[model samples]
Target: MLDSLSLDEFGLWAWWIIAAVLGILELIVPGIFFIWLAAAAAVVALVAMAVDIPLTLQVALFAVLSVIAVWTSRRYFARHEVPSDHPLLNQRARTYVGRNYTLELAIRNGRGKIRIGDTLWLVEGPDLPAGATVHVTGVDDDVLKVEAVH
Candidate 1:
C-alpha cells in the first residue's frame, strides 16, 4: 500500500496527518497554542495538494504561516484582556491596603505583629506601644508595611 503512491502524494498525506495530530494536541492542552500550528499544517497540506511544490517550499510555508498566526493571536489577546470580578482574589496582603487595624504587639525596631482574623501577620512600621492603631500602607513580600494611624 505504501509503495503505490509517489513521494509528493506521501508528503501531502503526511501533512494532513500532522495537522490532525496538532489539532488533537490542542484539545488536550490548556491554551490556544497548538491550534495555530494545526491550521498552518492544514494550509500547507491544501497548498501541496493544489501545487507541485517541493518539500522545502512546503516546510517554509508552514513556518511563515505559523509565525503570523501566533503573533496575530498574541497581539489580539493583549489588546483585549478579560476583566476579573475579584481583582485581589489571590493577593491576601494587597487586600489589607488602606485598611486600619489595632496593633496587638508593640513595634520595636520597625518590626511587629498584628492579628487579622485567625492569622498573625508580621508588620513593619514606626516604633509604637501596644494597642496603637496602624494603617496598612502596602505589602512588602510576606510582611505588611504599616504606618501610625494619626
Candidate 2:
C-alpha cells in the first residue's frame, strides 16, 4: 500500500490529514489558536493539488500563512475588544461598589462587617457605630472599602 502511493499524492494527503487533525484538536482544546494553523494547512493542500510544489516550499508556505493568520487575529482582537456589561460578574466583591449597606458590626479602627446578599463582607473605612449606613467605594481583595453614608 505504501509503495502504491506517489510522493505528490502522499504530500497532498498528508496536508489534508494534518489540517483535519488540527481542526479536531481546536474543537477539543478550544483556544482559537489551532484553527488558524488548520486553515494554513488547508491552503497548502489546495496549492499542492494545483501545482507540484517541493516539500520545502509547501512547509514554508504553511509556516508563513500560519504566522500571518495568527498575527492578523491578534491585531483584530486587540483593536475590537468587546467590553462585558457585567465587568464585576466574577469579582463578587467589586460588584458591591456604589451600593449602600448598614454596618452589622461596629467599624472600630477602620474595620467592620456588612451583610450583602446573605454574605457578610469585611469592610475598611472610618470608625462608625454598628447601625450606621456605609457606602461601598471599592473592593480590595476579599475586603470592601467603604465610606460613611452621611
Candidate 3:
C-alpha cells in the first residue's frame, strides 16, 4: 500500500474529483451513464495504490476504463431495456412534426388546440376556423406548433 499522503494521493484525489464532477453532470444530462465511469475511476484509484502504478499508466487506465464503461452501458441499454419512468424519454418531440390535426377552436395569438394520436394537445399557429385541419411543424413543451394543413 502507498503512504496515505504521497504523490499517489494526488493522483487518487484527482480521479475522485473528476469522477464526482462527471457524475453530477450526468444528473443534468440524465441517462444513468457517467456514474459508471465515475465508479471506474474510484476503482482505478484503489488499484493504483495496490500496485504502485505510475501516473501515465494511471491516466491511460482511467481513459480506457471510462470508454469501456460508456460503451458497455450504451450497448446494454440499446439491446435490452425500455425505461419505464421517463415518459418523454422516447424522444417523441420530432414525431409530431408533419402530422395533420383538426383545429378544435380558433386562437387569436398563435395558440389553439388539436388532436394527434388520440391525445389532445395545446396548439399554436395562425388562427383558424373551428374544424380546420392543420399540419404540425414543430412542438414546444407538449404543445404542437402547427400551420394550415392544406
Candidate 4:
C-alpha cells in the first residue's frame, strides 16, 4: 500500500508519522520536551508538502525549528510560572515543617529519629528522650530540624 505513494508523498507521510510518535512520547515520558520535536516534524512535513526540498534541508529545518520551539517555550514558562495548589508536593520534608511529632528515638548528641507514617525520618535538635513531643522547625538536606514543644 505504501508503494503506491511517490517518494515525495512518502517523505511527507514519514515526517507526519515521526511527529505523531514524538507527540506520543511526550505523553509517556513528560519533561516539557519532545512536543517541540513533534511540532518541528509536523512543520517540516507541511513545508515538504508545499515545496520540494532535499532531505538534508528538511532535517536541518526540523532541527532549527525544534531548538527554537523548545527555547521559546522554556523562556515563556520561566517568566510565567504555573501556580500549583501544593507547592511543597515534591518537597515532602519541607512540608513537615511546623508540624509536631513525638520523637521515636532519643536526641542523643543532637541526632534522633521521628516516625511519619511508615517512614522514620532523621531529625536534628537538642537532647530529648523518646516520646518527647517536638515541633518541626525546618529541613536541612534530608534531616528535619526540630525543637522541644515546651
Q: Can you write out model 4's per-residue Cα lDDT over 2-104, one digit (the tens) per residue? A: 6686535666798999999999999999588999999999999999999988988998999999999999999999999999898998899998999999999
Task: Estimate TM-scores for all models.
Answer: 0.64, 0.72, 0.51, 0.82
Cand. 2 TM to true fold: 0.72
The 0-to-1 C-alpha lDDT of every candidate, in the order given, reads 0.92, 0.92, 0.78, 0.94
Highest-scoring model, lDDT: 4
Please list the residue runs of candidate 2 whose C-alpha ends up more than 4 Å from where it truly belongs after superposition: 1-9, 100-105, 114-120, 130-133, 140-142
Better of 2 and 3 by TM-score: 2
lDDT over C-alpha atoms for residue 46 of model 3: 81
Ranking by TM-score: 4, 2, 1, 3
- lDDT for each residue of candidate 3 in 1-150, tens digit (9 for 90 to 100): 554555455665777776788778878887787798887888787887688778888878888988898889889988998867765567676677887778877755878777666776788889888799888898787777888877
Instruction: Residues 1-150, candidate 2: write the lDDT tens digits.
Output: 887875467657999998999999999995799999999999999998999889989999999999999999989989999798988788988877999999999999999999987888999999999999999999888999999987
Cα error, residue 49 of model 3, in Å, equals: 2.2
True-vs-predicted CA distance for residue 70, candidate 4, Å: 1.9
- Model 3: residues >4 Å from true position, as ranges? 1-11, 85-150
Worst 10 residues of 3 by lDDT: 1-10
* lDDT: worst 10-residue window of model 4: 2-11
lDDT comparison, 1 vs 3, better candidate: 1
